[model samples]
Target chain A: MSVNVIEAGGLGKRYGGTWALRDCSLAIPAGHVAALVGPNGAGKSTLLNLAAGLAEPSAGGVTVLGGRPAGSRAAADGIAFVAQDTPLYKNLPVADMLHLTRNLNRRFDQAYAQGRLAELGIPLKRKAGKLSGGQQAQLALTLALARRPRLLLLDEPVAMLDPVARHDFMAAVLTAMADDGVSVVLSSHALAELERVADYLVLLSRGRVQVAGEVEDLLASHRMLTGPAADAGRYAERPVVHLQRGEAQAHLLVRATPHDPVPPGWEAHPVGLEELALAYLREPGAGALPGPARGRSTQTSEVTR
Target chain B: MDIDKEIRTEGRPGGGDGETAPAGRTGAGSPVEFRLDAASGVPTYLQLVHQVEHALRLGYLKPGDQLPKVRDVVAALAINPNTVLKAYKELETKGLTAGRPGQGTFIQATLSQVTLPELAGLRRSLLGWLASAEAAGLDEDGMVALFSSALRDFFNRRGGSAGGRGTAGGETEGVA
Candidate 1:
């Protein structure tokens, strides 16, 4: 089994004089729907583009499908990327799109692709441009899966679709993962939706790595401590990722395990993926790089500078 | 957990589109389908584990019945396959289900249950309690809150984790 689908070290990319992503390093394990999340311009798309071999990094290095260089032929053969908006030829018929993709990839499943489209009720002869937004996204995803790659990178794949379409799109992704063992790394602004589907999470902010780890580890290691606002500062010496102050109560998202003693008059509640992610995003200066905690299931993340 | 809301018997979204049919099968087919309540404070895997236990408690699932395939559950629920596998692992750990290599997961045991007569007796008592609570001016939400707190207190009294789902710290403990 491939240990790490994508691994990077001091990975960075510069456009003109500005760095889109800088000093980035993380390991996305072989078997997960890893969520790459952050605000717009947080380098999510930049990182994905670099990993998909669409662009070269100006500094450091990255690899895909085990140790293969990101843009190498071996890596290209085992990876498929559907970028933002999934640019399908607007004028091409759906069947022609599939035909084009099949001819482009070395390992294309034409029959599987055809069967799935028919099941989705997408007419083979309809132009992609004429299809509904959901249908278009589905078409792109179907095309990607038809390649049967070992790893699939999707950038904002569901941001444009409606709730139902988003759900349908994720179901397709899940099916592909389960049946084909394809590892997925998708970036999105939809935290709630990702919570349901993603087992791993990588949070980026202002061109730097902020939080990265298995969703469960991040949730377990941190907690929402609600207490009197006045006493919140007393716990600042601890690893406080973010602190939200209310009129009377203060909620501090801190790095604490279950065995950690809860302070007097404070209630410690388990942090959630959405809650933790948003908190860290709100506190851009906060950095919880992956220390590769001892009990973490697999070290799918790394230290970030 | 609103376990049955928007449940699609078809494993895949397009399962009913002449290629695969999920609702047509009976006894030998998957006895339970999963529903995800993202709004529910429960974790995805725990929601699944709770659903299976719930199915067992209600006699909807039983010994020898097949749990839905991981592929089917993930397809229908649009969740990661690992989450499904984790729930199944939790069930296996609880001695409630077993995976038979080539076959799907099967219910290996049943939750200890209340008999029909006992259930009727309990329902009658609960209805009586509800009538009194109604007399006491408790609204539906109030009644639910009161019942939940009392149930939690009951479990807390036994010194066991509430809901017997101590798998994670995702859930908060209700005060007695």
Candidate 2:
């Protein structure tokens, strides 16, 4: 088995009285892009910060590349983080930004950074602060990618980019992933974008894990059951996540088989991560089918050709 | 059975034993149709979902239309399979597509209720955009003007309006 690039055990954090992340345990395999998703204040940022060693966990612990949050130089060099704000020296020219990063990081890929900027047609002499929102994101991402880090934690990296820039940024990420075996954990409300690139998903809500696993397996396990409200009791044995009961019909998010023998009057269809996420956040302890086996065990080959 | 090999085999054309190729084309048209936009705050899968949904709504696809298999889609689009699956799953949840075992995927004949969850997600994304616009010092009027101007520019760049507003019959024929 491959080593886990990121591993959290009983990870928990609290802000004054409220918990930010609690009992959040997840293992991200080496070289995989895992998307951390949830609603606002869902502890996504906290989890990322802890992973980056920017913030310490209040309860359990986090291990990056088989070491502590403040791991050795090797571990630290293997990881790079792009915060949600896309923080950068606004007055610094794009070329200066690249030069600074190259000086600071031993693994920085200066040529890669310069090439990325050229491909995107971003002016090298322009200051980061003066660049458009989309250009700034591209610059920041270029910096991170140039480092050739083993694990990259991006917190809403594209939240500020324009449509065209967003596409370009994602394309860059895909290219990097293809060329190198870097692992990524991105937390964003942009579920659609996350869905497009993330191989795995970690859903957290109110500081606790709601779901985590391969997207395909998760899709296979969860089904949107549509039928009469009266049939709810019949499916008590199946794993259900959220339920919406109308006057005559009922809709349920159930963990089920693709070919499960449905309860009489109940129709089952697969649920996507977006729907599962929405239902998970909207209603807690609502109608979710009970099960600890949230991770899908589908065999997936390496993406490399 | 080797699933990966099976998938690859299905992706190719002209491999069968001298069967008459269907239609006027030599190979399968590009089934994968999606792109990730860095400038847009909306996520990639959401863009794909909305675009695919829009296409379906505009009658670009019909019942029993086959969508590109998830694997083919990711490889062609250079995206994560999870995202395509997510979008496809969303459509499935909405009853817009049906997963027919061993038959790839097909569009459903009718759609069910537009679930509240779908609407809520859209609202959240729009709200995020609005907040950013607000931070950029764009007021309500500025926001409206920006959208209208952007829309006009987009239309102009595309070589003018569909000639006339809301060409209903044209739209019914999948002109959008």
Candidate 3:
């Protein structure tokens, strides 16, 4: 089996007395665009920070780039973390930003960076602080990509951009993946955008890993069932992730395959990625996750070609 | 390769995508450009696959025609490269396209499509119906509502006979 880009075994992080991410475990295999999604304060950033070696785990272990210790040199070389607010020297010209990044990293493609900035029409002399917020985000991403990290981690990279700017940013990220084969793990609360790029999904809720698997598998394993409200409780034997009670009918997100029998009077519909994630996000107690380690082991082949 | 030119038009100054600008491209102009419908609820990759089939069925893409490079599509649509790859792979699996080493993916076979005469005939009939629809004070939304209902009713009654045809026509009047 190929290396999992990230493997977290009982990982947790605490900020003082409160646990930001606890008992979290997931395996994101290489080559797929993995999206880490959750509500605010749901440990989305915490998990990413742990993976990027920016924070020491409060408890348990997290490894990146195929079992390399999170802070190890090998792992650092292969990973680039673009934090929520991409940090750069505000006073530095765009050109100096390139040079500064080049000096800090063991590897930097100066020509690639310069050419890209030129294509974007970003004047090299403009201070990083003078650029628009969207341009600043783009500049940060370019700098990260210039490093050519094997696994790129983005933390809420587009939460602040307008729709067009968001599209442009993601377009750059996608083109990079096509041109460089860079594996990406990006965290975002925006559900609509991820549907296009993210094949692998890791959903966190309230400091725990709620759902982790390939989006396709997760979607296929879950279905929405609609039927009379009175009959909803009778399906207690079935694993229902979220139940919505309507005036006379109830909708249930069940953990079942397409071939699973739909009880009399209930309609079964295939779930979409957004709908499934929302359902799981709404119901924290109804987890679709298996034992993390064993669950991800059988699914390692899904990512690598 | 086609990415640099497109990105330059964004008006937002450049960000590096690490895609080298390949000069002196000799391939003929591409035949189809892809667009996405966010409200359509169709998966992006499936939309791409459907677009390719549409181009094929419309004769815009013929055998040996090259599909857009993955990088170009990513730059154009702001979608995942893997999504494009998946669409191409699906096309390849169905024998509709084949990938040549170092060259872009090419159409391998043509999809069955309507002949010009048939298309013209269908167009005439549809235009005639549309004229009637407009004459009846059915605006665009009204026409859409009526058409979608009729279309749904028609499919709901499929596997039955033309018994469905009369009611579908009858239901169109209700919208008016």
Candidate 4:
């Protein structure tokens, strides 16, 4: 049976008067690598934290694998979270870290964990603090994989690693997914890297889910329309995500039906994941209604030409 | 497998050029490798599909050739395994490839081929046409645009003639 690895409903979290995440509803399907993407302070981390049970939502609720996150020992056991910095006991030897994981987790796979570290050529005797950034990331992944958790939540695990280390870490994650059928929700700002590794996407902007769905389905439904600048009223029926006006032309990203024909004089082009994410991220007034019929005045001033 | 035999006879080594060849085990007789370009604007699965189609068109991949395993592809490209499966499934839908239960996906049909003599004649004419376009002050982009426009017009004209009888009169067909 299919189940969402992570499901949120009107999920919100606030610190004092500032809201980190607000009104977010997302369901990430199991067994698919889902990318949680957004700019800095876009609440990407907060959402992941809620799912990991590291933080409680100020309003609404989120479930990981149909159970409240961190609500019970069993629920917590099903999730393995690798934080952005991949925090580990710095002074402990790599082998000791593995030993600690094996001791702490009920389902740790010792052979798998040791084998991965060995294959990566990381010495068991080296202290975690002494290891290179890439080695540390790999070790973090190794510990997570060894837990054999049903869901893995990684927050920018490779954001600090070099390109080669990043590639290696992602490769290890893919291998684990292939072998264990683990559901992964990786949060990152690296759209290009995510494009290669993630099949499912959840784009967050300003503490809101701008868009979320299977990558292929999202790409197929959204289109970039370029034509003469005019009032958006003519395309009122369509869900226009963002609109940018040039000197004499306007470019629009719209969630269009498959059979919906592009309006005359407008050229429709398929947009990539990065382009689609950027369009929504750059859109002003988070969760604002589609622009009015004021032709040029409605044009957003943020997008230059 | 006439195409498979033909590919073997072409004297192309076990692996084609390094860039296109997938770093995986080549099937018993047919050697076919796959690669992905993540930087391209094209979707990753579509890129795989296009690469396989291009390989088939160039006689590098044949009916019996085996595609790289899903794990191998995911490991090599650092992509999700589902993306590879999706690409293989798309190839299956197009009747270009099929998967065996335990073995990897194998090519199911060969791309249409042109006779060597006909291809030679067409290549020579194309070269001449390219020269003429260059002499006419057409840059690479201009030449491509002109050629594509001409090709589209040619196909649309044929399509209109074939289907225009039932269509509304005086209506203009849209360019795809």
Task: Provide the overall lDDT of each model, using Cα atoms, as 2-decimal numbers.
Answer: 0.81, 0.68, 0.79, 0.75
- lDDT score, candidate 3, position A58: 92
Q: Report lDDT (Cα) of residue B14, candidate 4.
A: 52
DockQ of each: 0.42, 0.10, 0.31, 0.33
lDDT of 1 by residue, A84-136 (tens): 97799999999999989988888899999999999999999999999999899
Candidate 1, residue A224: lDDT: 84
Q: Could you give candidate 2's per-residue lDDT for residues A126-237 as a string of tens digits? A: 8899998888887888899888887888998777776555655665566566556677888877765555577787877777777777666666666788999877666665
lDDT of 3 by residue, A1-305 (tens): 47899999999999999999999878899988899888899998989899999999999998988899998899999998899997888999998999889999999999899888888888899999999988998899989999989999999998888766787898888888889889999998778778877888988889987888787778767779999999999878666788999989999987777777778899998878888889988988755456223364333233211
Candidate 4 CAPRI category = acceptable
Candidate 4 lDDT by residue in tens digits, A127-236: 99999999999999989888888999999988898766777688789978987789899998888777778878887878887667788777766678888887545664
Cα RMSD (angstroms) for every candidate in the order listed: 7.1, 17.8, 9.2, 9.2
Clashing residue pairs for model 3? A120-B13, A120-B14, A121-B14
Query: Candidate 3 - CAPRI tier?
Result: acceptable
Best by DockQ: 1
- Say which prediction, candidate 1 or candidate 4, comes out ahead on DockQ: 1
List TM-score per model, in order: 0.86, 0.63, 0.83, 0.79
The DockQ score of candidate 3 comes to 0.31
lDDT of 1 at B47: 81
Best lDDT among the predictions, by candidate number: 1
For candidate 1, the TM-score of chain A alone versus the native chain A is 0.94
When summed lDDT is taken over every stretch of 10 residues in candidate 4 chain B, the lowest stretch is B167-176
The list of candidate 1 runs beyond 4 A from truth reads A291-305, B1-28, B116-121, B132-138, B141-176
- In order of DockQ, best first, we have 1, 4, 3, 2
Kindly report the interface RMSD of candidate 2, rounded to 1 decimal: 11.6
